[model samples]
Target: MTTSTLILPGSPEWLRYFSASKVAALPIKLDERGEYTRGVSRWESPFSLFHRMAGHLEPEDPKDEFTVGHAAELMLAALYRELHPGWRLSPGEVQYVRTDLGVPAMATLDRRASRGSSRRVVEFKTARDANEFGVDGTDEIPADYFIQQTWQMGVTGYTRHPAHLMLGMSFFARRLFEVAFDAEVFAFLLEAARKFNAMLAEGIEPELDDTKPTYETIRELHPDIDGTAVYIEAADAQALLDSEADLDAAKSFAMGRKSWALKQMGNAQYLYVRDPGGDHKKDVKVADRRKNSHGSVSFYVNKKADLAAITGGIS
Candidate 1:
């Protein structure tokens, strides 16, 4: 379909219900007929499909930077045309490809490349820093992009995947990684999607990650009730108590170290520690950086920046 035919999500209001991306994220376990499918986006977590099945799905916010990524892609496409004269980058539709489990999957190419019948998938990305794309020239695509681009290729039946990333917020630094589609990874994602979907259909909630956001999401879903109590395994209860005790002990030890450091500093606001074996080496500095109104002491490690000098490489 042409870009003109495509109705951007949240544009006309009614398109939200039938958004291809949204349909692809439905609980896989419930799709017995295997109709709904979607290509994974770059920013989405690998377990996003499973998350959808677990009833934790949230609408993609239009304000998200990924939403701006499309505009960036358009600009990049124009620049790429100037750099590579013969290549054509345009949108192409790939109808749903059936996975081994009979599920229909689809991929919306960011931009399809065609030069004399040779087609390639061009993935455009904007990263916060170069590190997100990994050390330059290593050809290492980050795991999230790997999962996303590979799925796009699998759906499009393309073997060549050319990913171009604009590194950093400045958008000046650039990195291009030529990633090959991996059959093993494609098979794994397909199977994983099916398995997670099945689990969700069976009324099983996905295991929560140890992150504050996940905790907050759960809390929002099920807030405190009026004198409600839930039962847990005795071992689980004991584990929580043990963790609490360990945390308290760790906190006490840390506080003790701070107290000792403060005593050693006395009138000075900083503490310097030297290596016992050598006097020539630089000392480690613990600086009293800032203070709050509550009279809390904040310590900061002052280290010299010598990455290039130390490694004989550019910083």
Candidate 2:
């Protein structure tokens, strides 16, 4: 019997398998449940996979209806089903699939959709605006989300998986993008999972990355600092000191540039960029200076600024 047939989805046996969504972000020496299990087996869900991969000591807390993003997901899924004809959307029951390296994995899709013989794995997401989802002008999705969907497609055995994104808090704006399963990416992920499991078996910790989750994990690992002194290699001590000096120099340089920009924008509330097209001239606001009631001034650049359109003269 195959691994999938051996362990039924959602069963106690299934809980021992690694989740496809968490495979990419699963930290070294950490169990599937975000707890240290050493040589024991554990399980993980898609909801907290991103945090787990980042070496966070704790998984993400459950979200409720009060969370805007979670609420938008529910609204978008329902509205999409109502608007589209012949499309049946149902909760994706847990699915089990094994990686090429023989790593048992499972996934629970956001929505399993079907139209006659055509089937798809649907994922719903919400952002403050279209820009966040790259629906405004670009074609980029977050790397973590892309990996999660790819893993889901592998488990569901679907060729097409589409993302349903809702922009803002309302259901007025929405966009859909079709994604295809990538065998090469899946193979790479499988190898990564194999390596992680190997490290877990040996109880080896992975090196830390420059992420907040990793930093927080380091802090949690040493909560109470005793007055005992530990000796470090001379080379390691020099490297740490050099890194601190570089960081301080970079900060000073950034402050100098900020001061120069503020001096150039003296007395001007807004900085405008003029783009000339044929006989027409279009003016776009690139940056603005605002003064609050507390008498403190702040400067900000327009995050939605069109860089291509503003490549002309600035005034």
Candidate 3:
């Protein structure tokens, strides 16, 4: 979608859901970044810095969405190949699955039904810890995660043998999986969707009690989205996980540092910030210091000079 026709062009509306991004950036769990970023444009205090730091406490990669989601999707495609070996993998599946929602994370897919001729509805476990699955082959799937994929199946109108699979297994050691259908899951999806739609109507995104809402919360609320927590057990699963883990770890480490990018917006030539390791860096924005040198994890935009290019160049 183009930026010109957006309902909430939050990239420029920095004053509504305002906060400071001058210290460390803390990504809000909800879709409030638009509102928050707009607000951050005018603040002038340490609190602004603090809020910015907190909002960007996690990593924000400079890579585009396709670059990021494509890697995960590619993994899923490979998993489908392993499970059904040459069983005509549908590009339509990608189109349907790429289906995301305006609410973000609550995406839906227009998939084929899992009824008579359908084998099962498979899901992938890109990230599974060591002790998640059972050893003796008793099929141990995390109920919450199972609910999510099952919910999607329910949304796609599948009633027969619905299963959630993992692409990676034998703990994080391996990375692939398969599954059979369950009726209990489909019923759960219907109820969850009913409630989730209501929350969206109220402009309320589901968030945890202690910490702010993360994207996980957004996906879980979808009634048609039962969760999946399967083990990763493919032959190449561990290798795949190792390769991706390094990338993910770097992103995770970068989050707190990126929050400090907000301080660059200030007119203060000498900006102070709390570095990711929790150390204060008085010389962070000094002259001749290249950006990546300090290892930033946030999107750096000058409120005065760079706000236009920050988001969609809204206002």
* Top candidate (lDDT): 2
Q: Please rank every candidate by lDDT, starting with the best.
A: 2, 1, 3
Per-residue accuracy of model 3 over 189-213 as CA lDDT, tens digit each: 4333334434434655333322223
**Worst 10 contiguous positions by lDDT, candidate 3:** 17-26
Candidate 2's TM-score reads 0.64
Q: What TM-score fits each model?
A: 0.58, 0.64, 0.36
Query: What value of lDDT does candidate 2 attain over all alpha carbons?
Result: 0.59
Candidate 3 deviant stretches above 4 angstroms: 1-69, 72-83, 95-116, 135-139, 169-179, 202-208, 212-315
Candidate 2 residue lDDT tens string, 85-130: 6788874333545554467566665667788887677777765434
- TM accuracy, model 3: 0.36
RMSD per model, one decimal? 9.7, 8.3, 22.2
Per-residue lDDT for 14-78 in model 1, tens only? 22222224333333222235643323343332244344334455544677687677677766666
Looking at model 1, residue 265 earns an lDDT score of: 77
Error of 3 at 117 (Å): 3.8
Considering only N, C-alpha and C atoms within 3 Å, which residue pairs clash in candidate 1? 24-37, 29-197
Better of 2 and 3 by TM-score: 2
